[model samples]
Target: MAESIIEQIRALEVLDSRGNPTVRVFVTLEDGTKASASVPSGASTGEHEAVELRDGDASRYGGKGVRKACANVNDIIAPELVGLDASEQAMIDRLMIELDATDNKSRLGANAILGVSMAVAKAAAQSRCDDLYRYVGGSEARRIPVPCMNILNGGEHADNSVDIQEFMAVPLGAPAFSEGLRYVAETFHTLKKILEKRGLATSVGDEGGFAPDLGSNEEAIELILEAIEKSGYEPGVDIAIALDSAATSFATDTIGLYDLKWSGAGRMRSDDLIEMAERWVEKYPIVLWEDPLGEEDWEGFVKFTKALGEKIEVVGDDLFVTNTKFIRRGIETGAANASLIKLNQIGTVTETVDAVRLCIENGWRAFLSHRSGETCDTFLADFAVAMGSGHLKTGSASRSERLAKYNRLLEIEDALDGNALYYWK
Candidate 1:
């Protein structure tokens, strides 16, 4: 028996769904098995996330070109990683981190490192003739996540007046993952029709969700509920609502202050924001609220969690950034009851997996997420099931980039051959 080793590694600059430049990596094993992975970027990115290298030239793509990151992968990372055993995931990731030797992977670029990391995992699975979930998570990877399908978009994701970053639909009553996706997709279409009939702009945001200037956040909630009902689903019973405030987008330097430019409501204090959120929670059946406070406002997080954490999932995205240290800090401070897991935020599959494990170990819910600027890579779909995270937020039920993930989950469900277990089940 011969060991499968990395025979070659290649990288290139690719355009994400948002038309932004991103890095894609290809890994080939000695046994001729090959796998490729692309990295996604975030618009409302956290301050503490790993560095994504970009070309600073003002002439091309407004300095967003990832040619430099691509070069780093080809010239730097590939040389260091080639010939290593493809099955050694943790070891490969650790070596990449050490080679970078920066707190945030600034030298080689997280985009480059993460691309290789994910590609290697995929290649290892290919070499073993196993699904990614089985290869990465072993026998325990059976739980299919409940999709948190975003139906409406606001904040930095859209050019609209709605303040909420994302308004999502969760199919909690569906018996299978595929059925749950269908329910959400129908609701998304129904919502589009409602928006169109109301003479609202049905343009999609960066994450494939409708971006309509609905005047108020309350209106967004009402429209979503109406859409669910119109789609023949019972709101709060068959399907539930979730929100991603992305408050850091409007966070000001002054503590407890926020500038909501969209609502024309001007600046609001932390207490007022919490009160508004509480009112919504009371009025609507929102099962999850993510980043309801600014990343730097630990006190606000504590207050919000203490107020409504028991009733709804107070998830931390910018607050945690999929970093274990920050996750531990959030745990100690009672900042949030759940953590959003974005693989690119941590820059490696192993580190991302570690973060999910930490959340699970501490009884905190883990939700695998996709970036607003995404590719057609369906990695997160497998990853969510593999980790048994039970929840997934991968944009809305539109766009090829977003649909690729949902469609892949459907295929996985079929492949599971009756062994699949959905989150609702």
Candidate 2:
């Protein structure tokens, strides 16, 4: 146990996939075991999420520098956490939360706190010579998530006219993680070819999904479905569609009134958006609808859930922010059927798991997810399996950063030795 005690912690300012400055934390144990983790940034961040600290210096990284966060980890957080046991993950996380003493980790920066939290867990797992999933989720952690490949991008993630943020292809019927990955990877290729045939741009967005100027949001779905069928797969049975409206991105002006400026759909009330969802769910093989309503639109969410909750999974991303407090509200109010779990949203691994437990224990599902700006670290793949969350949305098949997660999941499935499970339910 003494050997697993933390000996040193440090942080460095690093660049995310978007070339913006972010925090990367490293931890060293007394026994010479070391691990590191990089924090991901969200382009479409929610209003209530823990603050990702950034240096306001306009000179460095265009004011997105995270040197303050790195300093917090090296100067303050590192000194206090040095002698703690790496294996005491929950206690260590709680201590950090207390140290911050802020509601949203605004002072210390979620980037700083989460980087350390993730590195400590990775170091502990290395010290035990165990996988991170097994270390955090016990030995039963072998459920590889059904990958929801974001093949089409819109809203904040893309400059296209389409309003939906993410249009994903879920290979729910695939026998295993590797096969499922292959299935979607093939579909991604097919979609690109189809777009080229129609004279659309094959360029991708921040999350690597194609960002072509389409006629409308529904047209993106049409292209994806066509690709799924053309790739020798059935629509709903073999591949299901998932969406992330990321409504908060568009919810910039008002609380209840939504401005559909990107799609030219005009300003709409909550009911109008709900009606469109009802139509889409009936028309397409849509299995999941994320953030159908904005974060503060609780009543609208409940109404949206009631309308389509039985038909599909109504997921809350910005609505929940991977925090147990808002997840509890969603659970109690019947606002959403599931929550999108992002590790950095809540600033600590323990709280992120707590959010998942809150959702699952209350008969709701957890959709482990990645941010738009991501790192090559495969912690998310292990985390999705660890939580037994049936699904995860990384990105399209093009970028190496996105593929890194899928490649890691393939490795994990093999590591499970025929014991791994994959499903959407």
Candidate 3:
């Protein structure tokens, strides 16, 4: 019985490229039968402005320093798990912690180690004939509609200062992969044609010689609404719009000016944020919003959540950071109605699962998400559904990097008799 697990562990990390490096480790049973397992360096955030917040360096590896920190895990920790027991996941996880102990580095904080943990979990699931979501106990699966977050600055038809910081759009939750693909592609194509007719590229940033002027929030919203109506997603059913302001409201000099580093500006004023919330709800009909204010502004969030609980779901990404303390505080204070689950944010599969469970137990909506600066890993799709994430935020299914995750979810559904996921009660 354990031999099956051993073989599964051995098969981890079966894929790699210049952009990604993969490693396969077989956890051996006492009889020497190895479980197939493998680990691959997952996606990295590429050149994106949102990354500038961590430092001008692009890529998840660059801005957040995960690149430098996880680089060590590839060089060190991965080797320690070869020929280990995939079934004895606790042991493998223990090794990760022990390896990290040699130095004071946080095991989960190390991207390379976190990558290895993800691969390990994937293999472990295979041994059990379970998908990642099932393994994580996310039973009730629902495809929450996704909203588009347009990152544009003024130029051409758009302005340079992130014109419509966030927009709403949802992919049709088709029952078939081909249907989903065709729907998404045709929709984008049609959108391009219409925008072209209006002398616009239907783009967010500068492309070729044309740059879009996207500075005003009002203009941004109008363009987004127009795009939604044009794309035929308006009054969409079984779909919801999501938003990630990414602290732009505070990042601007006009409000909440603080010299504190990225980690410090958590406190936000209530009266101001509430006003913004009221204004946004009135204009956008947005169902999901992330990091609406500074992370530490607990009081402000409490007020906003109380006021907007029925109309929209206020989500916390930066606020939770995959840490239980922040999540507990949010729940206790009624600061947010949902939380975004990012594996790298906390650093390990077990920890990530724990966070999702905590969210479920607390009656908070769990949204599995990807970093803006992301690679082509498609694992989160399954994790989101299996973990009972009501929704997911990968990217527009257009970019291969983003599509990789979305497509993976479709594949999982295909394998499940077209009902591979169910919502958690």
Candidate 4:
């Protein structure tokens, strides 16, 4: 019999219990085969609404732009996917061009494109009885431990109403995942109460560490190290500690004044950043340091990465948008030992998968992640585990939304034969 013609495309709109909308897309094949993709619209902090993009702007949206693009993908591009071949990634990519050739579709475009890519890949993976990560080339036998988030309690980024530099104890080696989560919740609650008692906001800060004014970056680093030690995880061995400076270390004021905003500490001086990094390497068992310098400081990154070696795992999230071009740059400059993989960063399951492949093939590690402005989708946990990322970083075991990812991973383990040996305590 002749092959059936590709038939239909459909988009499903999903809203969180909070009523925030997310879009999912699916395409059908001639033989009744189907493929699908989806992404959640992440949250925003400090009045910066996450930007969404569409057909024309997928090429340029980076950082917060990616999240906005994801929203647009769900709202616009998903509907266009109806009545298309489930396997036609090339055709779809072409259609992306035709639909928004002006590339005006900012971050929203990347999100939409990525959503469709993920759905299509998932459908294909389902047909093979394999997980998405495994289908995309990640090994299934290993599961790396997830990292604990260090939240900013108060300081410069704080609305200035409170004493911010507080840290909580996360019982990392709890025998059960749920128990660990509970411990985290209890600890965070206690920390919050303490912050409140001191007239400080409990959940505010830049990069969730170091208040804007408590001291210099060196002082912030000392506090973080002390906090990690107190959190009860063995610094380097048990659950590894990591930093997410959020590009806060690399900003220049509007008129070219450097670092005037980071509590007058100014932008991170490359030498000072290197010094802090070296200190973390010794004082604390820091395994990961993300966005340590500004995105444009390629030379600084190269210098740090070359100096740190395997003593630490330098990761790039803002520096690369999970695109081949950025990955290639990292590879060329030796800027980092690992890369943060966020599907929405480049907008497609295939593209993101390709990025991971590039990393793994080139000896770089993968650290799949979640957005700070986030929802409760837990698919990423499964993806991270299945893909064999060196590790995952969602959030501390505090909010239900944050813990949901860890909970989902536990559930997946239960479904399997008590497997999931990669995580401990």
Candidate 5:
């Protein structure tokens, strides 16, 4: 058998769903098998994540152009990666990281490196004539994750009055990924109707969730539950709620204080935030709460987890940033019971998998996530199933970019021929 050496690697600058420039890479194997992958950018990004290189030209896309990242791939990375075995995923990723020689992949650009990394995996999978999931995760990668559908958006994701970042509906009772998506879609439409009837604006946010100016965060949760009930589902039994505070967006220099400029509820302390979260948990069927505290507030994380982590999932997004070192620290300090896994956060498929493994090994849950600024790439759908992650957050049931992931999951479920295991089942 001849080795599947990389024949050519090329990259291009593309526009994402948010109209921002991103990097896309194309890879070809020795035998002519080809594949391509694109990288997503995040709006509510963590401070410690791998750097996403962007062109600083203010005239083009407001300094968000990724032409420089694309140049890095075409000029610097392609030369080193060509002629290497495409099937050696870890070695390929490590070589890219070493070539950059930066702690956060700044020299070669994480966007550039991740584009090549993902493209190589896809090419290798194509060479083997296997699905991306099976190629990346092996035979046991048959479990489909439940959708954490973001029904409403606020904070940086939207220009709404609601302080919470994301108000989600989790279809935990569906037996298959397709059915789960259907349920969530129905609920999303129902929510839209409720907002329309109330004379609220039905515009969407960066992640395709409804961006309505509801009076309070509690009102947003109430509307979602109402929509769930109207869509013919029981609140706690058939569907559950999830919240992504993205609290770092509202953080201040004060250790335990937050400045909610748009929330209308100003200057809330850590205790106040915990109390509010506790009330929400008691009143609603919220199974997950992500980034309730600012990323640097470890003391608040410990307190919040001790208070509600036993009954609900306390997830760390900005806190861990999908980095293994931060994950280990979070595990040791008992900061959270779950971690949000974003491939762009760590900049490679191998490192993303390592983060998921670390979370599982430490008895923590891993929730695969999508960025607010995303592309049509459905890699996360296959990755979620491949890694056996029980939870996935890919915006709402609207927008083509968000729907692309759900549609891919539907295709994967069909391909499984009833052998796929859903999260609820």
Candidate 6:
């Protein structure tokens, strides 16, 4: 076996789908194998998540530029990792973590560290002449995830009337990944026509979901149901509804109180929201609900999960932040049955995989995810298959950045031929 030694690491400032400057890292192995990875940003980020370093220079990119992070990759991380084996992902990540020294990676920036980490993994996979999924997950990595395609936008992802951040269509009934993608893609187009017929805006949000100012958050689900039926799919059987409340966006300082200002439903208690969720869950074919309560409202989460955990996937997004400590706490408390997993949320592939392991080991689901702002990089697509989490939520079907992952999955499914598994659970 040849050693894939890290030769050079460099980061370039690049624009994400949201037009914000992000870090794109390039890694060259000793054998001349080169690979690059892009770092994605989140609009509704967790308060306790690893901090992303920015230029803070208001003149460039509205103080959102990641030039400082890029510098950290080029000037600091490159020197120490040059001689190390790129295949030793955990060691490389640990060395970078020590260099950062901050608990949330505030110094060198998670963006900088993660970019290099991902690029190193890609370079190593290329050097090994293996797919990213095979390199990371071995021969057992053949399960294709059921994409929770967010076809409608609200909350932080859009300027709209709905309070819920995302309304996703889960194509769990499709036999293969390509057919499943086609099912949702056809539904997305049908949804567009329905919205147009209703004289609503056909414009898209950050995640490529429709951003029409609808009557109510519940109405958004109704519209999607119509689209699914119109597209010749049965709701809950062929496709199911998934919601991401992102309650922290509307959560007040008072732990249980929330200001649902987006939908003009102003100020409601956690109990009220929980009851509302119960009613909606019973009424709709909802299979998953994320961020039902605020990050700080742990008691509310426990209560909410108790009411609906057995029926649906009560996911912790901001609640866990892709950290094992928080995930462990949630597992102990039974706060959620699943968690949203993102590489950048935890700052390293090793840590992100650790989070997935922790969730699965606890008999909980690990739901792979993409940030609100993304890129055309298909690392996440391979990662979803690698993790074998069975489900993922990567934006809507419209945006090219979002479609990139879905398209990559199609390629992998084709390549896998008869071995790939596709399902919701």
**Shift of residue 419 alpha carbon in model 1, Å:** 1.4
Q: Go through the candidates in order and give each one's C-alpha lDDT.
A: 0.93, 0.93, 0.53, 0.56, 0.92, 0.93
Which predicted model would earn the best lDDT? 6
lDDT of 3 at 217: 46
In candidate 5, position 95 carries an lDDT of 91
Tell me each candidate's TM-score.
0.99, 0.99, 0.72, 0.72, 0.99, 0.99
lDDT of 5 by residue, 133-172 (tens): 9999998888989999998999999998988999999999
Q: Kindly list the per-residue Cα lDDT of model 3 for residues 1-425, writing each as its tens digit.
A: 55433332222223232233233333344344323322322222111111111122555433433343334444566456655656565666668767776332343333545556666666666666666666655455534223232222231113344422344344435444445444444444554565577775445431111123433445545554555566665534422345565553344443443221222324444576578678877766567777666555666677778888778878876677766767888888898988877776665677677888898898887777765445566667767766756566655535466667766766666666655433211
Worst 10 residues of 5 by lDDT: 1-10
Write candidate 1's Cα lDDT for 199-280 as tens digits: 9999999998999998788899999999999999999988999999999999999978999888887899889888998999
Q: Model 2: C-alpha RMSD to truth? A: 0.8
Model 1 gets an lDDT of: 0.93
In candidate 4, how many Å is residue 258 off? 4.4
Candidate 4: tens digits of C-alpha lDDT, residues 1-425: 31223355455555432344455667565566676555654332111121244224345332222334444454566567655654465566567646655433343454466556666656655655666545554555445344455554333334432222223233445554445555444444444454466554454443243233454444544444444445554434433445665443235532112253544554546766677678767876566677666666778788889888678778887687576788799998899888878766665555666788899899988778765434565667767767766467666555565567777776755655555554431
Q: What RMSD value applies to candidate 6?
A: 0.8
Any runs in candidate 4 off by more than 4 Å, and if so which?
1-51, 54-108, 122-145, 153-190, 193-199, 204-234, 237-239, 248-250, 253-260, 423-425
Model 2 residue runs over 4 Å out of place are none
Please write out the lDDT profile of model 2 over residues 82-108, one tens digit for every residue. Answer: 999999999999989998999999999
| lDDT over C-alpha atoms for residue 142 of model 4 | 43
Q: Can you tell me which runs of candidate 6 are displaced by over 4 Å?
A: 1-3
For candidate 1, the 10 contiguous residues with the lowest summed lDDT are: 1-10
Clash pairs, candidate 6, are none
lDDT of 3: 0.53
